[model samples]
Target: MQVFGIAEPGAPAEEIEIATPELTGASVLVKITHSGICHSDVHCAEGYFDLGDAGQMPVTDAGAEYPFVLGHEIVGEVVAAGPEAGVEPGDTKYIVYPWIGCGECQPCRDDNENYCIGAKRNLSIALKGGFAREVWVPDSRYLIPVGDLDPAWAATLACSGVTGYAAVSKVLTEEVDRPIAVVGTGGVGLSAVALLAARGHKNIVAADVNEASLENARKAGATATVLTTGADPVTDLVTAGGGKLAGAIDFVNNGATSGLALGAMGIGGKLVSVGLFGGQLAFPTTVMALNQLKIEGNFVGSLPQLRALVDLANSTELPKLPITEAPLEAQTVNDTLQGLAERTVVGRFVMVS
Candidate 1:
């Protein structure tokens, strides 16, 4: 197998050849077709995440090693499977569920591998991911049939799509007609807007520092858009939300956005933070208690949520986010990570293998 990956911490990515793993038990080998570059990939390529005052959290903390492969949003076709695997190897393609965990754990048994009590073995972090010619999945169960979905778009469903869906699910407790703000209308945030609209939510407001992104959010079904470059972004978001927001999903959960999302929330409103954009959030206990506001953090979604998201895409004519494609080469992968880190890419970038 050939892969483009970081050879060492903080080093430029390059191509390397690795021997393909022999399948055993329920294991399956998939031929890579498409892989979407996520913002998290930028942090992975840099080998650490910014931890504000605490310093940097190395990717090694998540069990990543040298030559770390950095792509989890994968769409591929099964090329081979172990004798025990139920899937047949042919033309059928799938979205590989990357949040794998110890099978004996209760969370894994319940299909919520994202919350496994065991050490995290998530792909693109602890394991080799789709920035390669192929990927080896531990179990056939991790493969979700992609069916007729566009492979480029389907690649994102493994991560960004499900992440947005899972975060939006948290805020669904609010009335459908009430305003919900989606902060940082990047690929993931735009997906949340589309999902909210698909679920019949009438009031969806998108907030972003980029006017282009906010405009893209409007096309992705945002009922209103707030450019957060103003003197008071919180006020802008709140006004766009028709006073105060019933819920907010912060896809860019940093210092500014965390405050903007939380500040725009009304009484009893919930804020679901779903980004690796690192920063501490400071909120007064008095205000939190007085308003009965709830704050929650969300990681990438569980296996079940990914399945549901794919099903939703198949069944509904949801507004599509813009997608750009490039060849799955070493330089393309490196450039995509740089683009994400620089916050220049508007929507999803998929590398076709």
Candidate 2:
């Protein structure tokens, strides 16, 4: 098997040859077809997340190690399966749900393994992931059948798509008559815009520091776009959303975007922070109490949510976001990561194996 992975923290990923993993005890082997490079992969490779004034949160704290294979957005064909594995080898393709957990924990037992705190068995982190020609899935259950969607696009559903869908789901669960604000017009933000439109949300205000990103959001069904470069982006968002936003989904989840989202929300509005662009949030306690605001943090969704997102993608024509495809090579991986870190990449970058 061939893989492109980091030799150590902060080091660029390099191609390395290794023995193909042997399938054992419910393990399923997937021949990688496509893998999406995510922003989190950059954060993980850098070895820590910026925690603002509180300091840095080391990836080591999450049990990440050197020579790590960092790609979670995986779409592949089943090559082999253990006797206990439910899937079989052949033409069937599937998407791997990467946020796995210790199966015995309550969250895992409840099918909310993404929230598991016991042992973080997440792919591309604790386990080897999709940045290779082959990957070992701990169990067949983590595999979800891929439908007619493009493999490269379906690859994103493993992370960005599902994360956006999950965050949007949280805000739309309640009655919201006013336009909703989607902060950060990155891949996930654009996904939210498209998903919201598919779910009959006609009025959406998209915000981003990059004008190109904002344009992408507009193309993805945002009724309005707010450039977060102004003196008062919060006011800009509220104004663009027709004087009052029903709620805001902060896909940026940084200090600036958080503040903008918090300031833009109306009374009883919900703010779902979904990005891993780490930072602390400090707001007035009195305002939160008086306004009855709901601020929640959303991780990458559960299995059921992934299923729903897949069904939704199959049922509707999802607005196409920009996609850059590259061959799965050492130089290509390094270039992709560098492009992402430099914020030069416009949309999702999928590596075809």
Candidate 3:
């Protein structure tokens, strides 16, 4: 099988050939057909995350070798399977759950491998990822059938789609019409907005530094959009939130957006931080105590959440965020990573095999 990956930190992805591993136990091999290029992939290629004040946090393991294959949002057809693997080798495609973990861990036992405490088995991180012609999955259980969903869009459900779904689910309240802010209108942010609208939420405020992104947020069902480029961005958000935000999800959980989300919250508001943009957040303890505000961080999502999101996509007409396709090649992968790093990608970029 051939793969494209970062040969060195801060270098463009390059092509490499490797021998196909033999399947065992419940293991299954998938022939890659569609994979989404995410912003996290850019961080993977760069080898470190920017930690605003403290320093850079390296993602590279000292013991791990270079040319790390970076792609997690994956979907493909089953090509080969172990004797116990349930799926058959055919044209049917399934979205692979890339957040693998030690099945013995408590979180994994609870079917929430995204929160696994044991040895990390996450694809694109601890293992070779899906930016290749094929990926070896440990078990067929992680393969969620795509059904009639668009393959390119379905690829995102493994990560961005489910991440958005889980984050939006965290902020749900009985007061469905209350103002809720979605900070950052990137691919995941837009997904959150659409999910909120689909679930009958009446007031959704989308905030972003880019006007173009804000426009796309409106199309995704945001009742109001705030451009966080003015003198008082928090005030802008609060106004867009219909006086005070009932809840907020910071998709770009950087210093500025985090502050904006926290500052605009009303009493009893909740803030769910769901981005790896990287930064330290300092909020007044007194205000948090007085307002009874709750703050938490969210990883991608649980296995069940991914399955639920796929079901929702199949049942509802979720707004299709612009999906641009590029050939799954070394140069194209590098270009997509560069586009993500520069914040130029409007929606999602899917690589086709």
| Clash number by candidate, in order | 0, 0, 0
Between candidates 1 and 3, the lDDT winner: 3
**What is candidate 1's CA lDDT for residue 313?**
94
Among all windows of 10 consecutive residues in model 1, the one with the lowest summed lDDT is 169-178
Q: Model 3: clashing residue pairs?
A: none
In the predicted model 1, the residue pairs found to clash are none
Model 1: per-residue lDDT, tens digit, 108-222? 8888898888877788887799898889888898999998899899888888888999998899854787899999886788889999998889999999888888888898899
Per-residue alpha-carbon lDDT of candidate 3 for residues 165-189, written as tens digits (9 for 90 to 100):
9999899777988899999887789
The CA lDDT at 99 in model 2 is 89
Please give each candidate's TM-score: 0.95, 0.94, 0.94
- lDDT ranking, high to low: 3, 1, 2
Question: lDDT (CA) for every model shown?
Answer: 0.87, 0.86, 0.88
The true-versus-predicted C-alpha distance at residue 11 of model 2, in Å, is 1.5
Candidates 2 and 3 compared: the better one by TM-score is: 3
**Candidate 2 Cα lDDT to native:** 0.86
> Residue 251's C-alpha lDDT in candidate 3?
93
Please give the range of 10 consecutive residues that has the lowest summed lDDT in model 3.
57-66
